[model samples]
Target chain A: MNWEFILGRSLSSAIGSDAAVFALAAIGLNLHFGYTGLLNFGQVAFMALGAYGLSVTVATLGLSLWWGIPIGLALSVTLALLLGLPTLRLRADYLAIVTIAASEIVRFVARSVSMRGVTGGSFGLSGFADEFYAVNPIPGGSYGFGVVQFSARALWVIAVAWGLVAIISLMVYVLMHSPWGRVLRSIREDEDAARSLGKNVYSYKMQSLVLGGLFGTIGGFMYAISQQSVQPDTYSTPVTFYCYAIIILGGTARVLGPVLGSMIFWGLLSFTDTALRQAVGAGYIPTAIMDGTQVGQSRFVLLGLGLMLLMIFRPQGILGDRREIALDAH
Target chain B: MPTDTWVDGVTPEPGVAKPDPILVVDGVTRRFGGLKAVDVEHVEFQRGAITALIGPNGAGKTTFFNLLTGFDRPDAGTWTFDGRRMAGMAAHKVARIGMVRTFQLTKALSRLTVMENMKLGATKQKGESFARALLPPLWRKQERGIEDRAADLLARFKLDNKRDDFAGTLSGGQRKLLEMARALMVQPDIVMLDEPMAGVNPALTQSLLGHVKDLRTQGMSVLFVEHDMDVVRDISDWVVVMAEGKIISEGTPDHIGQDRKVIDAYLGASHDAPTTPEEEQRQLAEAEAALDAETAEREQLQP
Candidate 1:
């Protein structure tokens, strides 16, 4: 077995550009589910809007990339408002239902044949990242050390993605410590108690929804730019589930939880895939037992089992204090 | 006493007015489908006094409190707080206008620290604003002031030691203390407490009593619901008795203790004041006829 190749690929994937994207999305989920106790099952929808918003603005409306950023952010906020307006005042489960449905609707719309001219339908969109790379401050050359190196284009994207992740993490840390964050936590624990204290509970919930969606939108931007394309299937339901697994793997409510979570999640996933693929290729295992194509599906099964064990032994997750979880309270 | 007043065994009128009123509730009625939970004609709470609202089970005491504080809407009513019409105002708005309430089952925000719970009670906090929350300088001074006030309240309630602890860790009595302390953070003109002493232990009862009285000494109007007659007699300056959604009587502690309607509502109608001999005899004949009618109906159903 090629231990060197396996270790290098796993290490690189652990801190790759996709890790930054998942970090951003999970950080936003932390705000919704952790601090606010909102069950947002469709965080992927917000990411989709961010990607499609930027892509559509540039490819269809012919706007500049800079203009696309704000437009994408605005679209996310609007989506949050639409989702929150009806569900924020009701039971928390309603949000989970509405968000999941909303995300699915976004995917179907992007894939619809009638919208092919604008959205590129199932094929998605490209050629929108030229301006993004044109402004790249990185010199044209390979960067980094031994087996984890990136080409100039990859290096530029990783730099911007990781930088955004840092800024967003710092912002979340600051906001969660403030009095406004106190309100969110209070609402999470007891909505009536917060209401009795003269807090506008519905308004605070809407604010949290919009704020988290904005963070998710930034992550979506990174995702689209990293690929230099926007596709319908890329922002599917599994993406949200993956982000959730990352959060649960790291911890919830803790500011650095999702950031560390994404790194470890991606690393473990790649490691398992490589190990299983090698075992099957070397004929160490019979084809009837497991095949090469089955290796991809097996990694998720491993993740599912890992999540189950985490929930059973430590529902609060690593880096998360037991008291930090308000799941039952909600 | 006024014609509408009930002083010891005299039947009281439905609506009663008080001198120097601060909160005037009129024609406030709430119904749960066919059941009328509250249907008061008129009632006035005296300014800066500790008023006890006492009633048996299902007397709508809590429902009345909910309407006054805007926690629940009245089906038909017009109430005025400080002479401002406030029947349909939101609960938080009512709190913002210097009126607030506590719950029967304490809502202590169990996940929050006692200090955090107290800070939430403060109104118009600058740090609570979405934009200002990000900038520490903009609200740092105000937050410090709020924390100082919270610390002071925690100390007064003897919860200073538990300030950093989560409210869920608190005992029943401590949760009551926290709820009371949190309500006082509003510095309200009127504090409506729903059964503040319901689950309190005897040890903390005296201290909770002192806090209620202290609200009055500080010139804040205090209204509380209670079932413990001793507590009502010991602390209340005035008492309002309710039965089946209507105010049956209102008077001082001494007069309310002897009021026949109050006694009947609490001890059942068998404790009602004696009627005239001829009136009693006529009621006895009517009862025997009803008994015979019930027997005839029972005999028919037996087959």
Candidate 2:
């Protein structure tokens, strides 16, 4: 059963470029759900916009990659404003409904036949990352520690991605500690209390939405650059659910929770997939039970089981304190 | 009590004018579909005095408070606070303009530290701004000052020992105290309290009343809604009574206690206030008619 292959795959996946992407994405989700009680169910839409905003600017509009970044960020901000305006003043569940619908709209529109010429339709887009890689400062070679390795190009992406994650994490930490964050927590506890105290609850909510969506936008950029592609299907409903799992797995409201959670989530997923594939190949398990491709899909089923167990056993997550989670004053 | 007796020798009536008014409401009306919730033609709150807004259930007292504080928008009226045209302003803006209010259901941020809740109440916080929040050096000194003020308030409210604990851990009475102390952190010119003594133990009600009076001593106007007659009488320099959607009377607590309308609204059956000789005679005539009918029936039975 190739223990070496299994451990190496799991270890690399834990800290790989995709892990960095999920980290940024989950960080954004943490801000929205954990701290502010904003139920942003369509985080994937923000990510998709980030990807498309950059890709469209580069591939369709023929702009530089640098210009694409700002455009993508602005698109996310506009999306946040759109979602927050109608629902934030009302009950929070309305946002959850609006966001899921928003993500679906983004996906369908991107894949539509009329937009194919611009968005590349179902095939998605490529050749946009050439400009991104052209600026890579890394020298061409293989880099590895004892257990995990990557090509120079991959390593460069990983470096930039993790660096962004770190900076964003630090920023979240600082912001959450500030009085501005205090106001947000207050709103989460009771919107009327914050309002009566003279806090502009609507404005603060908008700010949080815009700010967290910006992180997801960055996640989109990293996803595009790492995979060297932007596909509508890649930023689907499952991606957001994965983020929710990661946040709950690590801990909500804790700054490092998502970051650590991302690493562990990807690691466990890889570990389970590799183990199952090997078990099937070695004839240790019947093919009728599972084949190689089926093994790949079964990892998610395992994730569901794991999530259930976590909810039952340690719902506060790794870093969350049980006392902090009692949003229910009862 | 009003230092200058601004209420003395003044006309005791609905929509009465005060000598030095801090809040003035004119033609304020709020209707919920078919029901008129509040319809005050004019009402003025005296500056630096404790004013109690009293009413039974659904009296529109709370609705008027909500309109004045910008929590609920009035349909067709305007109000002025501290001489500023404040009608239809956002609740936060009203608070920024030195007027703040509390909810009937106490809204203490339960998950936050008691100290954190107090700091949130302070106004003009530099750290509250998004751009400035990231720079510790920019807001750190100001934050420290806010902390000092919060610490003082926590002690004053006897919440110092529970400063680091979650606000939810506090007892009901303590939550009410914390909410009031937090409201004071606004450094407000006036504080509107909705049911400050609600859900509070009787032992703490006295202290809460004292705090309301203390707001006046600090030169801040105190307008509170209360059902407890004793509390209203003990603390309020002036009393405003409301029934159904209109101000029925305004006077000292002593006068409000004796007003025929207030007594009827508070104690008498809302629909049956008539008690006169003419009404008695009508009732007697009906009884006499019933007796004559009964005598006719008895004659028939005897035959």
Candidate 3:
């Protein structure tokens, strides 16, 4: 087992393009669940909308990628408003159910044969990222140290994706520090009390949902551009769950929780995969105990166990206060 | 023991009518199954005066407060605050109209800091809009002003030391103070408190009383429900007594304390009575006679 190679890849994956995307999505989730007490379990649906909206517009309809960006954002905002309109006024749990169901519906629609012409039906869409890459400022060849190198094109995507995440994170920090942000946290704490204080609770919740969805959509755009494709499978329920894991692992309400959690999650995942494959090849464990095929599934199992322990011991993630995590869902 | 004996004539005084009462509840009835939780008849809360709504357990004091504050809707009645009807309005709208209320149980935003809780109270600030919030100079100036106000309020409530601390970290008494201080951040014209002293420590009792008094001193009307007779007696400029969903008595603390009906209501006698057809007629007759007698008494006592 090459320890150096594993460590380098794991560390880079922890803070790489995928981490940036997940962190962005988790930031949106933090706004929905952490600040507004909204249980948005289908944030990936917004991501899918952004991805599909861009892919369909650019690849299928022959529109420019720049046009697709705004269209994708608009669709995401519209989806959020539609989901929040009827459900935000209801129970918090209802929002969770609706969001999860909505994401599944979106995934199904994307894969459905009825939309094959536009969505590429399960085969997915590619070639839409050319315009995005054409604007890349990086000159040529691979860069970075040891086995942790990335191509100029890959570096360009990582730079832009991470840059967007940082900008969005900064925006979120600013908003949360503002009086509106204070109202959002207050509503999460006690909506009735906030209402008694003249807050338009429903409006605030709607705004939070839309804003968070927009962030998730931005992550979707990055995910699409990085992969140079839009596939229905990419925006599955696990994607949302992964964002939740990142949020919980970092700290639900803390500004930096998602970013840190994403890095740790991807890092651990990469480390476990590398270590397990290396151990299998080295014959450290008998074939009866575990095989190469089973190693892929075991990482998630380990991650789940780790999460369970984290939740039991410290429900608030590493950076979050326990009191901050006890949401007034009622 | 009988319906006839229960009809003791007690007249209500039609004192000097102010220009306009801050809040008026007329025949508001909120029924829960067979029980009428609140059946408040005509009751007026004067502007800029501290009024205490006193009753024993299950006396409908909190229910009446809920109805007036838009937490719950009344089955049959109308309520007006500052010439605006607020009977069926949402709680947020009621608050927007300058009538905010605290809960019997503390409803502090636990996750939010003390300062954030106070800032939430100032929701109606013009800079809360998305466009306004995005502009630094515009929103920043408004935010700073709100923060200053919240800081001052925290100082007044003696919670300035814990401004940066989450509200959940505060003691029960401190949370109550934070709730009260947060309510004032909106600059409400009338503040309704439900059991402000219920869970407060004895040491903080005086401070809570002072805060309630300060509301009146600052020309804000107060309607509070309290189980502690001592607190009610000490802080209430006027007391309204409720029993079985009705405002049975209204007067100064001394007058209410001495009222036989008010005493019976508190002693739980009101709940023991039967609501038969014959008893209802008899009570109605007694009420008419009491109204006449009270009018006559007030006329005689007038200047």
Top TM-score model:
2
lDDT of 3 by residue, A55-169 (tens): 9999898989999889999999999998999999888999999999999999999999988998998988987989999998899999999889899998998899888888988
- Once fitted onto the true fold, the runs of candidate 2 whose alpha carbons sit more than 4 angstroms away are A327-329, B1-4, B268-303
10 residues in a row with least lDDT, candidate 3 chain A: A321-330
Q: Where does candidate 2 chain B have its weakest 10-residue lDDT segment?
A: B265-274
TM-score of model 2 (CA atoms): 0.93
Question: In model 1, where do residues sit more than 4 Å from their true spots?
Answer: A325-330, B1-14, B267-303
lDDT of each: 0.88, 0.91, 0.86
lDDT per residue (tens digit) for residues B146-182 in model 1? 9999999999999999999888888889999999999
Query: Each prediction's interface RMSD?
Result: 2.2, 1.0, 2.4
Best by lDDT: 2
Could you give the CAPRI-style class of model 3?
Answer: acceptable
Interface RMSD of 3: 2.4
What lDDT does candidate 1 reach at residue B150? 95
The structural similarity of chain B in model 3 to the true chain B, as TM-score, is 0.82
lDDT per residue as tens, model 2, A251-301 = 998999999999989999999999899999998879888888898789989
Query: Against the true structure, what is each candidate's TM-score?
Result: 0.91, 0.93, 0.88
**Considering lDDT, which of the candidate structures 1 and 2 is the better prediction for this target?**
2
